[model samples]
Target chain A: DAGVTQSPTHLIKTRGQHVTLRCSPISGHKSVSWYQQVLGQGPQFIFQYYEKEERGRGNFPDRFSARQFPNYSSELNVNALLLGDSALYLCASSLERDTEAFFGQGTRLTVV
Target chain B: SQELEQSPQSLIVQEGKNLTINCTSSKTLYGLYWYKQKYGEGLIFLMMLQKGGEEKSHEKITAKLDEKKQQSSLHITASQPSHAGIYLCGADLGGSSNTGKLIFGQGTTLQVKP
Candidate 1:
């Protein structure tokens, strides 16, 4: 079975610009969550969606937003990108809560 | 706030040696998960411990959840080059977080020398 997949393996943008990262969850997976992983640190939770609904959100600023598609795919949008927003944006999918999660290769964003 | 904290932010061990990584959470977690990631790659789930005092093993890796359910440990037996990576511990606060919104620790990077 194919695992989670992400688009635009790498991206570059200037400050104050906007970017969108896409994610396709594993087959039959109903949950999709987004995380931001800066260098030398762990991934920070951003948003989580289940059954096409916004289930939870993290402590990110209003610049970060996300949505889930009917097919369980997800998109993470970052507005007014800052250099600090440059990190590996990871998308993880799980069958359900407390279940093992599969991750995508992630979108590496670089803000100049 | 960061609810989970990991120890030994980084470690170096010789090949065939054993090492253990610890993770502690400010709040009791409903589920604790261990994941490993190679530089520039995605994370791979190692194990998940839900109930307190639970233990599980996979190949050379073993994990245990403390009875208090606020702490967990990952022990790698006979560490190898393949085990050289960043190990992250994630905790799920049982609440409305059914979407697998896990809170992760800062991570411990293990370097094994041959």
Candidate 2:
């Protein structure tokens, strides 16, 4: 079975622009979460959704948001992107909350 | 807020040598997880420990959880080139919700010298 899949694998956007990254969870998974990983740093939590409802959010700016679909696919949206927004966006999926999460290859976003 | 601190941020070891990395948490850990990530790749889950003094081993890798001390350690024996990567330890705070919010350490980068 395929693991969590994310696309497009790479992206580039200009400052003040918006970008949407997508993720398709593994089959039979019911939870999806988003994380941002800057170079030389561990990933920081962004948002987590279960059963198509927002379950938790991290200490990110209001410009960052995400939602999970009925099929358990998720999309991460960043508005008013800044140079600091350039980083790797990772998506994870699990059978349920608090379980082991499997990650996708991640989308590398570059804002200039 | 909970935080995880990993010791020996990076290490270089010769092939066939053994090395260990430690992860200390500021607060009690309901569950501890170990993951390995190669450069430009997503994290790969290694193991998870939930009980105090629990230890698990996979092939040449071993991980231990000391719940009483809020500490965990990962050890690799007879390391090989394939063992070179970033090892990260994550903690579950176990909040009212099951969001699976994980607090991770800075990570330990390992280099295996051939």
Candidate 3:
């Protein structure tokens, strides 16, 4: 079975621009979450969705938002990106809430 | 705010030696998870422990949850090059955190010298 899959593997955007990262959860998985991992740091939780509903959000600013689809896929959107937003954006999926999560390869975003 | 702290931020051990990394949380952990990652890559799940005093092992890697449920340790025996990576511990914030939000530690980087 395929694990969580992310799109574009790598991207480059300028400050004040917007970027959208996509993730497709594994088959049979119902929960999807997003995390931001800066260099030399651990992944920080962003948003989590289950059954197409927002279940949890982290300390990120309002500029960072995400939503889940009925099909269990997810998209993370960042508006007016800043240089600090440049990092590896990871997507993880689990069988259910509070369960072990499997991660995707992640999308590397670089803002200049 | 909940925080996870890992000890010995970095380690370099001989290939045949053993090493242990610890993860501690400010709050009691409802669930503790171990994951490994290479630089610039996604996390690879290792194991998960929920009950206090619980212990689990996979291959040469072993993980244990403390009785207080606020700490976890990962031990690797006869380490190999393949085990060289950043080990991270994540804690589940139970109660209002029904979404399975995991707070991760800063991570411990392990390097095995052959």
Candidate 4:
């Protein structure tokens, strides 16, 4: 089966602009989570959605938000982007909550 | 303070040698996960440990969890170029519910020389 898949493998946005990244979880998976990885650092959790409900949220600002669809796909949106937002946005999916999660290739966002 | 701490920010070892990396948590860990990532890429799941003193191995890699001490270690025997990458430890902090929210360490970058 195909692993978690993400769209727009690369993106470039200007400061104050908004951007949306997409992720399609593996078949049969129900939980999706988003993470941001800065250069030379490990990923930081942003949001987690299980069964289409917001299960958990990280310490990110209000500019970051995400939601999961009935089919288990997810979208991550960043508003009023800042240069600090330039990083790798990763999407992970698991069979259920607290299970082993598979990650996508990630969308590299570059804020100019 | 960082919730998770990984030792040896980076490692450079010759092939055929063995190396070990550690992850220490300040808070209790309900579950500990190990993942590998290439630079600027996504993470690849390696192993997960839930029980105290539990150890698991795959190929030449072995991981052990010590719940009492809130520490975990990853050891690789006969390291190869393929083993080179950024090793990260992610943990689900102990709480009333398992939200699947993982807080990760700064990561340990490993470089193997042939």
C-alpha lDDT values of all predictions: 0.91, 0.89, 0.91, 0.92
Q: Which residue pairs show collisions in model 3? A: none
Tell me the spans in candidate 4 whose CA falls farther than 4 Å from its real position.
B67-69, B96-99
Considering DockQ, where higher is better, how would the candidates rank from best to worst? 4, 1, 3, 2
TM-score of 1: 0.96
lDDT of 3 by residue, B39-72 (tens): 8899999999988999999999999999999899
Q: What DockQ class does candidate 2 belong to?
A: medium
Over A65-106, each residue of candidate 2 has an lDDT whose tens digit, in order, gives: 888888889999999999999999999888988688888999
Q: What is the TM-score of each candidate against the true structure?
A: 0.96, 0.96, 0.97, 0.97
List candidate 1 stretches off by more than 4 Å.
B95-99
In model 2, what lDDT does residue A76 have? 95
- Tell me how many clashing residue pairs each candidate has: 0, 0, 0, 0
Q: What is the lDDT of candidate 1?
A: 0.91
- For all the candidates, what are their Cα RMSDs to the real structure? 1.3, 1.5, 1.4, 1.2
- Give the higher-DockQ candidate: 1 or 2: 1
lDDT by residue for model 1 (A15-34), tens: 99999999999998999999
Writing each residue's lDDT as its tens digit, candidate 2 over B9-114 gives 9999999999999999867888888999998789999998888999999999999988584999999999999999999988776643243578788889999999
